[model samples]
Every structure is written in structure tokens, then in C-alpha cells.
Target: MSDSSFRILIIGVLIACSLTHVRSDASDHRYKVGDVVPLYANKVGPFHNPSETYRYFDLPFCSPDGIIKEKREALGEVLNGDRLVSAPYKLNFRDEKDSAVACRKKLSEQDVAQFRSAVEKDFYFQMYYDDLPIWGFIGKVDKEGKTHPNEYKYFLYKHIQFDILYNKDRVIEISARMDPHSLVDLTEDKEVDVEFMYSVKWKETDTPFEKRMEKYSLSSSLPHHLEIHWFSIINSCVTVLLLTGFLATILMRVLKNDFVKYAQDEEAADDQEETGWKYIHGDVFRFPKYKSLFAAALGSGSQLFTLTVFIFMLALVGVFYPYNRGALFTALVVIYALTSGIAGYTAASFYCQLEGTNWVRNLLLTGCLFCGPLFLTFCFLNTVAIAYNATAALPFGTIVVIVLIWTLVTSPLLVLGGIAGKNSKAEFQAPCRTTKYPREIPPLPWYRSAIPQMAMAGFLPFSAIYIELYYIFASVWGHRIYTIYSILFIVFIILLIVTAFITVALTYFQLAAEDHEWWWRSFLCGGSTGAFIYAYCLYYYYARSDMSGFMQTSFFFGYMACICYGFFLMLGTVGFRASLLFVRHIYRSIKCE
Candidate 1:
């Protein structure tokens, strides 16, 4: 196909996909009485290790018939380890059942062993009925046994009581309650007769369907957590304000005086050897080495920045709710893929501006810069999940689909963007002329070195978000559901402001110390925040959370590494952009003849 035809095809595909939401009968949500309400049994996993999940039938659960039907799920749902399959229990809308035996099976020795293992590990099963999710533990452990003082007893929860709340035609809420009376002891060696029973009670509620998910967000402890988030946000705001104040002082008082003195000296024709940043004006704006890599980072960072803002905006508008499984992830994947063009354009244009000749190489690098590492990490983690037979492993079809999307949709857009960027490329507009020979950077004290300056630059920004990071980690790794996007949005802005101000300040100091190598240093200074974040991840994994086991640990670190790498790119871009502007503004203000 021609380039234009391919572009049109890609755009059409994107539009079609975007128009398609999660395929579900629950979209309308208005159901008549006696309408079949499909109940889907999702995954089962140890409650402590959320990442490690298995198909519900992976256990010796009673099967309905010959071949169980699996519901078609969105990309996000599949990625989230949700395997929605038809359950044995049958229920209709508003059709309440007093009691019904779902299935009856004589447990074999192997079955008993599996149940015992699951019960001992505190395994929980998830189910969905009419789009509302419900969770219940498979079994329980009793520490106080009748036989001995310190002996433990394991019992399976054989009966499930489903209390489903409805408002007129719409199902508002659902909860699965286990009955203690129906517990079966797993201590016996003989084959046990297990009758899996369930009771459905439909209750009428005055709550509107729109407000159904409010209950999840209004947990008793949520207010306290929100209060803490508010306090942390306020603290970050104060920090940004102080940093901004310091930057303003330097810009208005120190830099202004220097500019005025330099102007006077130039007017008087007094060329008495210049000092400080004024002497190195020729080399300050010189394009750094590895122009392609720098440009690629900037491009990838730009794309990430845009993606973050868009996702947060969607979240604030309630496009992604806590109850909606995989909506956020789905949105993220689609948005990131669609926005590949931005990365290509920015990276290619910047490279061209730096007088880079390798357009094809730059475009390829920009396309793979972030996705390469992410793909590798995902492959490793997915391998581990597959080895463990965990539901977190992507199905072969899903992996193929993701790869196809990247190759067809993302790659084409990136190439088109790079072509446009290269065709429209302009020269680097530096205010000061460059000298043939580079200026020798003076020896600086330990604190003024790159590492120390990066440490200082990264610490301030990391401090702004460390508290918020705990909440994020809790939501991502633990069982907590995060819904405070407004607060997250606030903290996000604060982090950017803090990063920009701190990086600009550090760049100014570097220039004052006569270091013409501020290009990579500025990027590193901003990117160093990722290092601090990774450190916090270690602290959180070891001390703040109870997450263990090889699968969960690998998944956690692999994904966190990807997230922190993104942070490095995004913040590093922010820092570099800010420093570039500062450098340009200062150079333009002075007479550099």
C-alpha cells in the first residue's frame, strides 16, 4: 500500500477500535424480570499474593458440562488476569432462591489434598454476576482446635450466600457471604461427600444505578487515607512553592545583576577576562554527544508526558472507575500505542536540529526506546507466570494481538511522524556563536560535581511524591483500590513543578561552575528521581507490604522497573526542556558578541 493509504487504514482502524467499548450485555443494564443473569467465575489465588492467580476450575471445582464456555474479554481484562467463565449456578434477574445445591461430588484423595493446600494458603475466589464483582475465601484456618491447645484446623467453605442489591431493573451491588455452618473439615483421610450449595437473595435498594460504586469508594478507612493524601499534597505544594521562590530570587536578583554588569563591560570595551557562566557562552549551547539518543529520550518522554495527562484526565472524568476491571490498563495500552507518533516527531525533529544524519536509525531508536525494555521485562515476567501456571500469564493469542498492534499501528505512525519531522527539520537556534575549540571545564568541589548535583536535584522531586507513592504501591501491589485521581492529578503537577525548578536551579549552578557539559547532566539530574523511586520500591516491598513468593516478587520488580524507567524518561525530559529554556532565556538576555 502507498504511504497515504496505509496512514488512512491505520487511522480508520484506530477509530473503529476506540469506538468499541467492553463487549458486555450489562452496557444497557436495564433488564426485565426472569432475564438470564450470567454468572462468571473469574480467578482463584492466595489472598496475600494478588499477582498469582489461577483459573477457577484449576482447583477441583465441580464442572457444569463437557466444555465450559469462556466469555470474551477486552485486552485490559485479559492483561489483568481475569478469566471469566460460565459458572454452574443459574439465576435470573430478581429471581431469589432460598437454597440450591450447585453441584455434588465425592472428593478424591487428590481433590482433598488440593483443597487442603488451598485452604491452608487462604485462597480466595472471585466471581461476577450482572457486572458486579464478589469475592469469597475458599476455606479458613482455625488456630484453636478442639483436639489440642495450639493445634490448627482447616475447613472448606462449602456454602455461598449471595446478597445482590438491585434498584428497579439494574443490579446495584453484590456480595458473597460464606456460611460458617456449612464448613467441612479437611482433616479426614477418607473421601468426603462435598455438596457445593449457594443461596441468592435479591434485595431492593433506593440507591441509583449511577451511585452503585460509591460503596466501594466510601470504605470506613478511605476518609482517613484521603486526609493523609491531602496533607501530603499540601506538603508537596509548599515544597514546590519554596523551590520556585529560590529560582525566582536567582533569576531576578543574581542573573539580572550579572547581565547588567556584562552589558556595561561590553559597552566600555573592557575585555578583562570573563568569569562564571558569562565566559562559557560559546560552548553552553553546543549540541551534546549522542545526539540521536538524547533526541530519542526527549521524544519518548514527550509521548509519556502526554499519555500521563490524558489518562489522568480520563480518570478524573470517571471514565475509569475502581469497580471497572481493566479499564485503566486498557486505556493506557491503547493511548500509548496511538501516541507513538508524538515520540517519533519530537525525537526526529530534535535530532535533525542537532545536525544528525541518521534519520532511519533515530526513528527506529525512538520507537523502541521505551517499548524495548518494557517488552523484554514483560516477556520474562510472563515466562515466570507461565511456569507457575498463573492466570497473570498472557494467553498466546493475547501476546500475538499486542505484537500485531505494535507492529502495524505503532510502527507505521512512528515512521510517518519521523518522515514529517525530518522533512520539516530546522537548524539549532543558539543565541551565542560557538568557538572552534571547546572551553576547558574548571575543577569543582565534591558537592558541585555531577553525582552530588544529581542527588540534590532528584531528592527534592522524589520527596514531593514519596508519600503518594505509598498509596500507588498499595493500590497496584496490595488489595487496596485507588480512586482519588483528583489528588493524584494534584501531586502529579506538583512533582513536575518541583522537578523543573530543581533541575533548572542545578543547571544554573553547573553553568556558574563553568561546566559546559550541562546537557546530559540536566537530563540525568531530572532522571535521577527514578533511582530514588526504585529505592522506595525496595523499602516498600521489604517493610511496607507482605508480598512474597517468586512470582509476585518478579512481577512486582519487573513492572516497577518499567514504571521507574518511564519516570526517568518523563522527568528527565521535563528537566532537559526546562534547562534548555532557561539557558536560551539567559543567553538571549545578555550581549554575547
Candidate 2:
């Protein structure tokens, strides 16, 4: 390690970072379905008419988001006999027949003016359905067959309607003549899909939900929307408990053994350094002989589990939608860099609490690994996207702006979080001090090392969840339409239970065989099963998929990301256990007398 080499390495990193910023700042968001994009301010170019387009006023803004409908005069001049039955409630539906059974409301002339004025004034929209455009109006048609800027269309409620919103945000507040009567003839064949074609916001004439439901709230109308509940919290708890319970049950059994008890007593003499809490911690800086390695491994695994949950929840809540028009993508790109801070803060602080030397090295490793590679990879992607207009394309300028935002906004936040975490001290107090010297050299063979134990521990759980994980991977990497949170909720709960039990059982078996290096082995043993899952993906390609060329390469890159992510999770677990083991070993060595 000469000075020139270190300087060159620093220079290389700087160049890579500069390139990323230049590319990330040149674009605006390009939203798609499932992206929680905001309702954009309408551009005036389309509506900057010298001559007015015909505008229909006094229309229900709340009428099924899109499609214009009027009353169908029952075959004209025929004698009226059969009564028409309308559906109980309205929903954005497909086809004229699907929208609703029939219109059921009565619209008054006075109500028209107020609703029209409100729609024109404050309502805004986000495009939902990319296939077609949707329009809203609140005016009337003039003599030239043009929609006058301000005029009302005399109509009633329960008119023709369509659901133009799907996988997009719906109006939080707005008004429409619910149960209105149909006025125009939109016959059976012309179908309109009920996805939100755009996002809509409230305005003056807009009626809030309370008032909108006022008329029909009397009877239970079709339920407005279903409640979405996630099982992650409960799942995380089950995961933690199962893992801990198994460890506790094993520890209790091991403590009951007379020989084991004697050895533990013999090793307790390592803690006599006696300066402060820091000195006591320093005694622990060696490999753990007991089950302490498994504990640290479990903690690291928990961190990875929670990280994924946190990110996904934020995405659903609109902070990081998948189709954030590149904004979300850019953020994802830079977030790994920030996660370095979290990893560093968590890893370094934990290890530091063990009273190990080389604090600076540990901190540096914590901050760089993933972030460094992630920055380089994204820059490469940006370069490719610029040269070729890929579907996952990002504008050069937008990329630059993204870089600035990441550097300015995310960098400080991470640093602050890291500092705060460092100051908090270790969350877990060491179970006991380390021994002064390594335990009586065990003659255990190489095959029983942490690697084998960890390998077995992670295999089955990964196998069980492999299929589900793949389907999810496809939705993202294969560019498929997937929006089933209900199913995901169920799957997450199941995985938590499975992974926890498997990790603990495997860790216990290794220790029973008297394997002392269970710390790193325990975590990776359970986590490396992801590598097998990746192998399954390869098999899937050869068997079921018909992907070709770029698709295949993309599949490779996508899986690469998954593997890298999994690698960190595995390694983080290993690192945590190793730190604890190192401390346990040192304490035992010193105190054993």
C-alpha cells in the first residue's frame, strides 16, 4: 500500500462519482401505472384555444372518473311497461353494461352551475391509464358546436359512467351526482375500462366524500374500498421469537451439563481488566466459544429483513413508487450509498462495543462496500440508457439533478443517522466477558467448520420460498404487471415463520456437534440459500421462459442485484457474530485463570 496507489484509488472514486451526477440530473419524472406520481399541473398548450372547444357544464365530477354518458331514450315513442333496475352503487367499470346496471339519480338545473364551476376551478389530474387519455369538463356547447368557456349542461344524476382509474391514485375529495339518470345514448358495445386514467384533485364545485355519500349513506352502498393490512410487523415478531426461543432452549440445555458448566466457570476469569465499560468490552474481542455467535448472526439477519420491509412500505406510501418516472429509480440508485451509513453505524458500533481495535477500518468497510459498487453500476446504466432509449431510460439532465439531490439531501441524512447510531452505544450487552486465551485446542475436522453449518442452515428455507421470490422478481425484472398486495401479505407472513425456525435449528445442530465458529456460519448458513434460489432461476429459464437476447441479459443483471443484496445480508450476519465471538473469546481467555 504505497501513497500513489491510495491516491489513485481516491481519484478513481471521485471520477466515478462525478460521472454519475452529470448523468442523473437531466430528467423529469416519467410515470407509469403503480407509481404514486402526483397530479401534475395541466399544460396550457392543448387548451390554449383561440376558438373555444365545446365545454359541458353542470356535469358530475364524481361520475366514474372518465367517459361521458347521457340518458338513452327508451326506443322512443314505444309504450312504457317494463321497469329498469339500476345497480346498487357505482364503480369504475369496463364496458357500458359493466359501469353500472342503470342510472338512478335525479339532477337539478341549479346543481349544475355549482358543480361545473368547482370542476373548472380547482380539480387537477394524474394520468393513470397510459393507453388512452381522459378529459373532464364543466361548461356548455355554444352555437358554433364549440364548448363555451362557461356554460352549463342541464342533466340529472345516474348518467352513463366508466371506471378510468386502475393502479393510480383516486380523488381524495370531489363531488358527482351519484345515482344520476342517463341522458346520452352510449349503447352496449362501446366498452370503457375502469382504471383511473388520471389522478383527480378537489376544487370549488367539488363535493367531499361526506356529502357525496350523504344521499346514499343511508343504505350500505357498494363498499367504497377495501382496507389493506400488512402482516410484516407480526411476521417480524414471529421471526424474532422463533429464532430466540430456539437459541434459549439450546442454551438452557447446554448450561445443564456438568462439564459445560465447569468449563464456563473456568473461562469466566477473562473480565479482570477493570478500567471501565470500555475495558470490559475490549476483553470480548475474540471468537466466541459458546452460543454467542448465533446471537449476533440472528441480529444481523433481522436487520436485513427489516430493511426490505421499510423500503417497500415507503414505496406503497408514495415515497418510492416503482414508476416514479425515474425519480424513484434514481433514489434507489443512490440509496445503497446511504445504506452504507446504516451498515457502518450498526456494524462498527456493535463491534466497537466489543472493544475491538481498528475502529477506523471497521467504519470504513461499513460505509463503502455496497455504496461504492452501486454508484459504479448505476453510472454504467445511465451511460447505456443515454446511448439507447431503453424502456428503463432516464434523461441525462434528470440524472444530474438526481445526483445533486442524493449528494445534498441523502448524504447528510445518512451521516447524521450514522453519528446518532454511534453515540447510542451497543443495543445488546455481551452475555459474558471473553476468555484470556483460546479454549483448549479442539481437534474438530475442517468439514465441521462454520461454512458447512451455515450452508445447511440456509438451504431449506430458501428452497421453500424460492418460487414466490421468483414470481416477485419477474414482476420487477421481467416488466410484468403485478399489483397484488393481498397475496404478498400472506407470503411475507409465511416466510418469516419458515426462515426463523430453519436458522435456529441449523445453528443448534452445529453447536451440538461442538463447532465453535457458529457466529459467521450461523447467519450465512441461512442466508446463502439465496444463491441456490438464483440457481433455481437459471433452471426456470431453461425450462419455462422463452426470453431472448436483451431479456436474457437483463435477467442476468436483475439476478445479480438480488445476489449482491443477499450477499450483504449474509455477510452482515457473519460480521455481527464474528464481532461477538471475538469479544467472547478474549473475555474467556483473560478470566479463565
Candidate 3:
């Protein structure tokens, strides 16, 4: 063909392809009512407090498509017994006929007994599709009331119906509707029947999940809270900047004067005399007494720091698309196991630097300090969940998987990292040699003491993230969805900066008070922010939140303790590194003889 003819032909082909693409996009597949869809239970929560939620098993119902019908789990399957019984659901279309309901399987005496036990424990079921909760129910059935054993009181859903639409053999659409009765009195056991009624119809929609979410999931003001708190966040930023500026100015003036004094002629320098931190320069650089403990903490802190950064970055970048707590938790566990090398290296290197010889002991203790506590706590929590038959309890297979991750992935990485760190040399260099005997620390005033300094230093770092904490708390406890990774990232950075600066300032104050024992103080000062965070959590639980179940309460406080401990490690590491740099710079600048 000629060039002009070929070009014309190409244009025609391109046009046809574009048209086909548009048509394909516009005519996506449609779903029918009888076709069973996967019903995900993202997390189960108490009625009063949705924020405190736990992951549970999903439920599958039988539905028919054009060609096939999906089968439900076996009646004997004990999956999510708290929310649903294992008995098969026999469908009925009639609403008024008791015989039709009676045709369906009635709860056996054993089933009734188990169900009654679950209801007494306040167990409820909430169904979620896509990332939103669609249906919620409590096992409220008519049973003998405690007030009057002779009379029966209704407890569960008084009216339950499923609206289904089918076209010939294919089921096209489905939705659930229910009118729940007053809270059931479960104090007494009375055998009861469970039944479901259905109404059939047909409707088509482009976005089923979105439509369902709108109809079922109650809208919350969590986003509004995020927007409203922007001013307070900005205020916190400004306050942190001012405080850092003041601290920087004071340190600069003091250090500059010290440098000038030390730079003087021999006679003049002698007359001025090295005082405060300068007086104990030889002892300040001395390895702390609990070298093994220090090394272990530093290693764990480094690992947690990296994990925090990685998680925030992933969230900010939308890697955690659904942004559910379960996903976040899984990612953390996997990442932490992978990052064990970093933790091992940090601890081993620091321990070696302190001229300690117990490499194996240090590595073992390091792993135990953080990971051991976490594992123990997890086991305890899991036991509690199992006792309550809470879905949050991990299955045996999942527990095995976690153990394998720790033993195979984390443990090996720790050993490799410890070996590497032991082999490598640390860059830290002290201008003055450590003295054999420790310098006698002078008596300090109340304000200059370690407790006062730690208490005061922690507040600034906490303040930096206080505004953001509201949203974080809501996401964890309330039905609020957290998606602003950018905001979280910014807050994390601010927290780091505040922690470092405040810790340095506190260290300076302690040293100036003629205290040479700054090794632990620096870590404590920054790590203490976790204490404040825990305090705020208590305040939120008692004063700001509506959470009421003992299970939720236990879970919240239990997990919060672990979270705060990790926070302590991260912040403490930042502070210690900052203080170390600050001390090194001051000594190096001064001609310490």
C-alpha cells in the first residue's frame, strides 16, 4: 500500500480499538442476588465502643448464581461461635407462617445451651464488606427474665429479613434489614428458636459496596475532627520551634564561652578552671555500669525506630490501602522479623564498644529484652481472648506461623547482625580518657535531679504529637478511618525533633549540676515521653471515650503498654544519640588536656 493509504488504515484501527476499550469499561460484569459473596468481618467490637475492636472469622451464606449455588460451612463447624452458631441456615420466603419457620432447623438443646453462654458473655456479630461495617447484631433471644422467671422477655432481633432479587435462575442483588428488640436478659437459660425471613426483588447498581456502605455504616465525624484540629497542630509546631530555639540559644552561649575560656593561655586557662561537666570530662566518657543492658536497649531502640519509619512511610504512600488495624499489625510483625538484623547489629556493636566480652549473653539478652516481652504479652492476651471465645484469638496455625517467623527469620537475623556488629568498629572517639574511679557526683537540687528532669523533658515531645493523638486514638478506638499518612508522617518527624532537642537540653542541665551520670539519664529523659502517652491514654479511656467491656478495656491497656514500651525505645535512642553528639562536640571543641 502507498504511505497515505497505510496511515489512513492505521488511524481507522486506532479509532476502533479506542471505541472497544470504552465499551468494555462501560459494560462491566453485574452480580445477581442469589450469588453468595464473601462477607468479611474486618474486626469485631463491643456495642458501646467501636474503637476497641478485634479481628474475627468471616461468614459465608448460600447464594445461587445463573449456573451454581454456594454451600455454607458444615453445621458442626465451630467458626465464630460467639457471633453465629454452626447450624445451617434454612431459607424461608414466608413471613407470617410459623410452620415455614419450623421447617428450618431449630436450635438443638446443646446449641441453645452454648448460645445462651455466648449471650451471657455479651458477644455480638458485626459484618463488614469492602472496609466498611454493613450489619451488626447481638444474640438477643426471648428468655426468662431475672426480675420474673415466669415471664419471657425478648432480647435479640425481633424482626429479621433479607431482601433478595433474582432474574430466572440467577440471583442478582441482596440486602439485610432488621429491627432489634430490647437488650436480652441472659441471666436465665430458656430454650429458643432462630429463624430468618426473606423478600425477593431485583435492582441494579454500579457500586454495590459503596451503596451498601452508605446505607449500613453510620457516618462518623472523624474527618471533621482531623480538620478541626489543624489549628491546634500548628500551634504545637510553633511552640516546639520556639522551645527548640530557646534551648539552642542557651546551649550556644554557654558552649561558646566555655570554648573561649579553654582556648586562653595556659595561666589564664588554669585560673578559669574546668568546672561542671568539663570538670568530670574523664569520667563522663566512661562506659556505664550496666553495659549489657545499655547495649540491648540501644539495639532494640534502633530496630523500633526503623520499624516506625517504615510503617509511617508505607501508610503515607498508600501501600496500606485499606488501612485496617489487622493489616497494619500483620505488616508490622513481618517487617519486625525481617529487621531483626538491625537490632542485633546495634546491640552487639554497642556492647563491643563498651569493651564487654560476653557477646553471646549480650545478644541473647538483647533479643529477650524487647521481643521476649512482646511475645509473652501476646501469648497472655491470646489466652484471654480464647477464654472469652473472642475472634481476636489467633488460631493454632497462625500462632505457629508467628513462632516460625521469630525463630527462623528474627533469630537468625539477630545472630548475623550481632556477628557483623562485633566485627565492625564504632566511630565514637573521646577526647579525654575515662578515669579508673568514678567522679563523686555533687548533691543536686530538686529541680536539677533526674526525676524532675525526666518528667519535664518528656512533656515537650508529647505536646508535639498531642493533637495527632486524638485522630490516632479515634482510629484505634472509634469507628474512624485513618488515611492521612502525610499528616502522620509530619507528626512523627515533629516528635523526633522535640524528643532530641528536649533530651539534649535536659542532659546539659544535669551535667551542669555537676552530675557525670548522664548515660542512663539521656535515655530516660527522651523515653519518658511514653509515660506521658500512657497517662493520656488513661485519660482518654476514663474521660474521653465510651468504651465499656472488660475485654476491650483489657485489650486497650494491654496493647497500649506494649506500644508505649516501643515508643520509649525509639525516643530514648534518639535522645541518647543526640546527647552523645552534643557531649562529643563540646569536649572536642574545648582543648581538654
- Number of the top-ranking candidate, with TM-score as the measure: 1
Global lDDT for candidate 2? 0.40
Mind giving the per-residue lDDT tens digits that candidate 1 earns over 350-421? 999999999899999998899999999998999999999999999999999999989987898888778878
Q: Per TM-score, what order, best first?
A: 1, 3, 2
Model 1, runs deviating above 4 Å: 1-27, 145-150
In order, candidate lDDTs are: 0.85, 0.40, 0.65
lDDT of 2 by residue, 171-252 (tens): 2222332223333211122222221122122222344422322332222122321121123334444555666576567655
Q: Give the TM-score of candidate 2.
A: 0.48
Q: How do the predictions measure up, each by TM-score?
A: 0.95, 0.48, 0.77
Compared with the true structure, model 1 gives a TM-score of: 0.95
What residue runs in model 2 are displaced by over 4 Å at the alpha carbon? 1-306, 315-341, 356-361, 379-393, 421-428, 445-447, 486-490, 493-501, 509-514, 550-555, 562-593
Among these predicted structures, which one has the highest lDDT?
Answer: 1
